[model samples]
Structure formats: structure tokens, C-alpha cells
Target: MMRVGAVAAMLRAGAAVSLSEPELLGLAEHVRPGAVCFDIGAAYGMYTYPLARLAGPAGQVHSFEPLPVPYRILEAGWRAIGARNVRVTNAALSSSTGYQRLRLPYRFGLPIHGWAHLEEGLKHPGSSAAARIVEVPVYTVDRVCELRELPRVDFIKMDVEGYEAEVLKGAEWTIEQHRPALLLEIEDRHLGKYGRDSAEVAGSLLARGYRMHVWHRGRWNRADRVSTRWRNYLFVSWAAERRR
Candidate 1:
């Protein structure tokens, strides 16, 4: 069932700053009416809020943010924006369903890397900010869909720090079921933090018959494999094995 509670959210530019990730342009451009979108790790509803607008009344957006503060902000944003089709949930998407110890950031902290930046701040010590570690519930896309009774997802955007692999792992069933396009953040430092390689992430998707593409230097390029930049990437799930 959809978690019921008061969540925090904010409205920016009236455009929904929650959907403010850099990689979504490619996916946003192709959005259609009645489309169903999922924004995993949706911090503060930047992606989720705007997507709720894009999808319009006919389309729907399922936004998941587990971090206590972020999840609250997401909920608030939904209420502030008042999109009838938007659904916000307080949970995380992962390769498995369980609890995970996560690093908490100092006030106004900037990520030294990706979502795993809290861990980096701890290891580096030279970081200007301090962090606290906390444990929270984790779940997978498949589990979320099953719990919410959602059948199809048109687009899936994930930015789970360095845990993209784990998120994809839990999404195997959903990937096969919805076959939606994916826009994920895959940086070398982030992947390295989790000891995962791009080949595994990219190869796994390719093997599943999803077409791959990458956003490079402001242009969207359809790549046969993962991009070399490793900063951020967009993986489009095409209908066939037409990898390019």
C-alpha cells in the first residue's frame, strides 16, 4: 500500500525543482500523454514534481524517496504543487528489500562524489562538513510496484548514489515487465564506492535486450555500450536488441 503520512516538499520556479536532475532532458523530450514515470531516489521531488506536470492529468508519476527529510520534502512538494496524478512514497529502491546503514550529511553539505558522498566525507576527514550514519528501510522497484499495484512504467530515473547496480538488480522483474526507458546517474567514483563496474551495469541491460544511449557534452548520443565519462548517463530501454 502507498505509505500514508506527511512528507516534506518544496516548489521552485513553479516548474518543480524536484525534477531538476541534469540527465532527464533526453527522457523528458520523449514524454507522452498518459505515460507513467518513476523517479527512484527522488530527492525533494525535483524530478518527480516536474514530471508530474509533464505527464499531465492523464499520465502518472510515482516518486520514491526514502531519506527521512527528503521524503518529507517530496510529500510537501506534492501537496504544494497539487498534481492530481502524482504519487509520492517514502521508501527507497534497491537490489533487495531490507535495511541499510547510510551516511548522514552535515548541514548544507555538498557531495564529494555521488550519493555515497557521506561515506567519502567520513573517509576523507578533510571534508569541510561532518556526517552521521543512520539505518533505513530499503526496497526494490519490483517490490514497490507490487506493493503499489502499479503495472506499467514508461520512464524510470534512478540516482541512488553509488548503488545503481543494486537498484538495477532489484528491478529485473520490473525491467522485464514495464520495459521503460531509464535515466540513471553512473559515475566512476560512485560505482567504485560500491565496487561495481560499468561493464556489469551496461552489459546487464544490453543482455536484457534494452537499447542503450548516453548523454554527452549536451548532446544525446546513442551508444552501443556505457559512456566513458562515467559522471552521469542516460540508459534508454528500447523495445529491441537494436543496441547502437
Candidate 2:
């Protein structure tokens, strides 16, 4: 069961709370019915639920969340909503398959659970305490697709704190093969903690023929270069763009 307070807070906010960005919801509209989607770092099924709903019953949604607390909340929410096509996985996606320690931070006696990352040294914003390290199973996108026999992924929404680069590395094969449209969050400051930069992150996609666009004031603006500030980016594959 989810903490009563948390559940209430979610209910109060409704769909708007989960799909915080207008661009994300707009992107979801692009997913046709019966498309397969992946929601990385799907905390509490916010975006997951909306994506699943948009995909409809014929489609499938695979969501990944490593932390136990949020994972439980996410699973229960799916069950409560009777989302049959949504599969919630209690694992983190990374560059390799195996177990890794996730450092979760605390603030004001409450866990800043969503900010937890695979990098041990990374720090969360706001006043924090010693991190609670939890062992979590990790899977690469390729590994998961191979193991689960997933259909060609049509879209992916990835927001794994600062570990987006590592996750992209793991999904390289999937990206090359599927050329799925991507909604990625970039926080250069957080990436710096993992010895990564925005250019390196954006370069990974650009090298694979992805055009980068940033969401601003309800519209997507093409970005020739990745900025240092934290923001969300839409990476459309060249092939997909051509089709559009």
C-alpha cells in the first residue's frame, strides 16, 4: 500500500501532476494505438499511466523503477487502475546487466526518492543526509528486449537522473535497430557528477542521426547544440523525421 499522504497528494494533482510537461503529453499523442513504449524511471506511474492510456489496451507499456518504495507505489497504482497492458519492472536500466548500488538521498526526514541514481557519489539537490545504498538488479535495454521478446519499441521516455548517458549506451543496439523517438531529460550538473557532459550525451544520439529539439513555451525548438542548463529534449531519428 502506498503511504496515505503520498497517494492523496497524487490524487489531488491528477494527470497534470504526472505529466508535468506539456511537451511530454504532446509527444504521447504521437504514439499510435498498439505501439510499444518504454518509460524509464517511471516513478509512481505518473507518465506511465498516461502513456499506457494513450497506447490503449492493444498496446503495451514497460516501465522500470528500481527503488522499492516508488516501485511498490507504481505497481499498486497499475493494479488499482486495472492497466493490463502495463508491465512494471522493479529494476534499473544501465549500461550493463548485473547488480549495482543505488544511492537514495533524504531531505527533511523524507526520502527524496525519485532523485536516487546509480552513481554512488552523485548528490541530490536540497538539504540531504547520508545516502542509503540499496542493491538493485540492472538491465540493459537490449538485454530486456531479448529476454522479454518485446516487440519493436516505438517510443521511449528516459529520465534516469544523470545516468541518461549510461542508459543510452546500454540501449545503443535498440536505438540503432528500432530508431525509436526519445524524450530525454538532461541535467548537466548531475551528469558532471558521473563525469559526463551534455555534449557527450547529445553526441551519442546525434552520431546515430537524431535531431535534437528542446521544448519551450509549448513548442519544440531545434537545438543545434546541447545547453548546460537542465531541460528536456526530444530526439527524433532522421528516418522518423523524414517519414514525418
Candidate 3:
């Protein structure tokens, strides 16, 4: 049976800031039974629960959330559903291991919970939306793997605002060693706010021999160029032996 309450309500409502059911379903297509998956920027466990279910009892799902509010909700939801294979971490993954300020903005008299980001600028700089700054622990994917003694990583789904490049930089070792499939969101405007660019992000992955594909309408389409419009992309490592 599914759990009840706010988390379940949110899941049932299917109200996610930048995620859609089709996208989530497409992501699940990449996961295999007993796979080890990482859910970065896992707000309220929206993708975490589904990922855990996909991974199955023998698999594991590590969910990372920096914001306290969402982290708590994520934890609660995980327990509510009795998901034994999901591990929740209240930290942000970045290019380095340390603490960083996360900017959160409010909208319609309430926090726009999912918009909180570590991109160095507020999404609504001069708008009426209230802003909250919080210092959250940060870890590199390499460090996380080492500390947790993770055996292997099969897939990673990241939606860290525009900090995707930085996160990838930190996960270089893990990516090289495990060659996990990647699902990331790329927004040129958001990257530009922090002196980064989408082209650079895509180029870095391509340099590592990962083929890029765009996710749309519940399917994967090969993308040779980066578009300005915000959307999720799937990067499959050439070294990956498993095929879908």
C-alpha cells in the first residue's frame, strides 16, 4: 500500500517544478533491477521513490537534498512508504567538499521550495519573492563514494539547477570508474548566472566519450547540438557494457 499525507498528496498531484511524468518514466527506462541509482537534488523525494521502486529490493537508491525542508519531507516520505533500499542524504554535491550558501526564493506567499539553488544568484533577484540563504554541507561524488564504500553506481539523475557542470567535475573519478548513465538538466540562462555555459557542460561529457540524447515526449532523441531552451538530457557512457 502507498503511504498517505502531504508527500503522498504531492506525488499524487504530480506537481513538480521542472519534472514531468514522461520525463520520469523515460528516466526509469534506463534503470535496471538491482541497479544502484543516485538522485541528486531530490526535492521531496519526487524521483527518489520511483527510482527506489525501480531498483527493487536488491538495489539501492541514494538521494541527496540540501534544503532542510525538502530533506525532512523526503525522509518522511521514504519511511511512510517503507522503502528499505533508499538512503537519504542531507547534503549538496558540488565540485568540492565543503559548505556553500543555497539561495531559496518564495512565491505566492510560500517558498518556491524546488527553486532553491546553489548557483550564486537568486532566481528572482528583484522580485517580490522573499529569499532565504542557508549554508549546507557539500560533498564531491568521489568523496561520497569513498566514504560510503559504494560498490558501484549504475545510474545518476541530476537536476541541480545550473550547477550540473560543477557536479560533473566533482564526479569525474566516479564517472570514469563506473561509467554510470547520466540524466541531467541543462539551462544556459541558469549556467550563465554563475559564469558557466551549457556548451562547456555538454562538451565535458562528450570529451569523456558519453553520447548525448535529449528526453522529450517520453522518448530519447539524439542531440548533436545544445539548444537554449531548458530540458533534460541523457548521457550514456561509451564504456558502459550494459545496453537497453
Candidate 4:
């Protein structure tokens, strides 16, 4: 989940603004011109715009955001920039394609659109409560890739709350074939909502020869173990690792 303040700041910064944070700047190092990138759980087009800029006019950027409010904002931001390389999808990506209840959690009487998720039957921390439940269509990355006829996928940045594992499950074909670099947000608490853990998520990728790297001190540091504190991690294939 994203922070409300951060999301707001990014939206105010506009699509043309350049990224300054080290972690965001680091993504530019991995993405090359003509790269095909996916920004899953793109709240307000924070990473989507930068990815579109990095991919350039020749490349394609697919951004997914299930929530209606943010989806509209994401769409508006994309249009505001008049970018032709980006495609905004108003759907969530999971293991199966269907409709699911998207929880819009609220705190202090304000909806925390940033923490909105698809996990049902889980208690949120603080005063976070579901302000609304909406049925949003879901799709698998493989299905979308097949439908869109994507020649190749160079990179994927996913932050679908606790459903990261489920998304990976559906994206197996894309992962195996393209071996694209994956930047994922995995938190133990969030995973608990779906009866999952970080290891279960990382295990599947590691088994497929994807090495985990933590962003630290303005660089990607390879790690055999997941960071106990940080939730964001970059996973790359053995071939990409060799290139690095």
C-alpha cells in the first residue's frame, strides 16, 4: 500500500516532473529505450509517468490501477501529458480473471485510497476500515500479454498489496519467457491478509533463478535474504544478474 501524503505529492508534482528519490531514480538505470514496462498498482501514475518517459516514444508502458478514484486520476494524468506510449488499465491483476471486492480502507474518517486492497476478511492496522466495497474486474498478466500481443516484457513493477503472490502465479508464463526484471513490494503484515508470507512469495521466484536485490545507499545490493525491515525489492533473472 502507498502513503496518502506521498501519493498526493506525486500527483501535484505532475507527470512531467522528474523523479528525485534514489529508489525511483534507480529504476531508470534498469529501464532502457524501447523497453516494455508494467506498473502494477500504479496509484495516481507515480511510477507510470516515469516509466513512460524512460521507455520513450518507441516503447510501451502498461499501468494498472483497480480503484475508480485513482484510476480516473491515473488516466487523467496520462492524458494530461498527452503521452502515446502509456496504456492505463482500470483493473487489478491476479491469479485468475474475474470480479473481486476491492477494499477501500479509511482512517480518521478519511479514506486512505493508498491502502485500498483486494484482500477480504483481514483486519487492518490503526483505524483503517473499509469505507466502500466495489467489484472490480481482474486479469492475469499472461492473459493481458496474450491479448495485447506484447512482443516482449522487459520490466515489471508490482505493488498490489498482499496479492503479489497471486499476481506472480498468473504471470508465470511472462516471467519464464521474458525473464523481465521484477520490482515488488512485499510486506509480512500485508501478506498475512491472504494467509501468505514473504518467503512463500520470494521462494517461487528464487526457484526460477531470480536473485533478490535490495536498494540501499543509492545502489542495488544483491541479497540472499529478504530485508526484514524494507518491503521493496528488485528481483532479476540469472541472465540479468550476469549483465549487472
Backbone collisions counted per model? 15, 0, 0, 0
lDDT against the true structure, each candidate: 0.66, 0.79, 0.79, 0.81
Q: Where is model 3 poorest over a 10-residue stretch in terms of lDDT?
A: 1-10
- Give the per-residue Cα lDDT of candidate 2 at 209: 96
| Candidate with maximal TM-score | 4
What does candidate 4's lDDT look like per residue over 111-134, in tens digits?
Answer: 778678885435543355447778
What is candidate 2's CA lDDT for residue 58? 83
Model 3 local distance difference test score: 0.79
Model 3 misplacement above 4 A:
1-19, 119-129, 228-230, 241-244
Looking at candidate 2, the ten consecutive residues that score lowest on lDDT are 1-10
Error of 4 at 51 (Å): 0.8
> 40-104, model 2: which lDDT tens digit per residue?
99988666766776677788889999999999989888778677778999999998999999889
- Which parts of model 4 are misplaced by more than 4 Å? 1-21, 120-130
Mind giving the per-residue lDDT tens digits that candidate 1 earns over 21-123? 4454444565567888888878876577656656667888888776777778768867765767888877666777877767655656653212433232122
Off by over 4 Å in 1: 1-22, 107-130, 216-219, 228-230, 240-244
Could you estimate the TM-score for every candidate?
0.77, 0.87, 0.86, 0.88
Candidate ranking (TM-score, best to worst):
4, 2, 3, 1
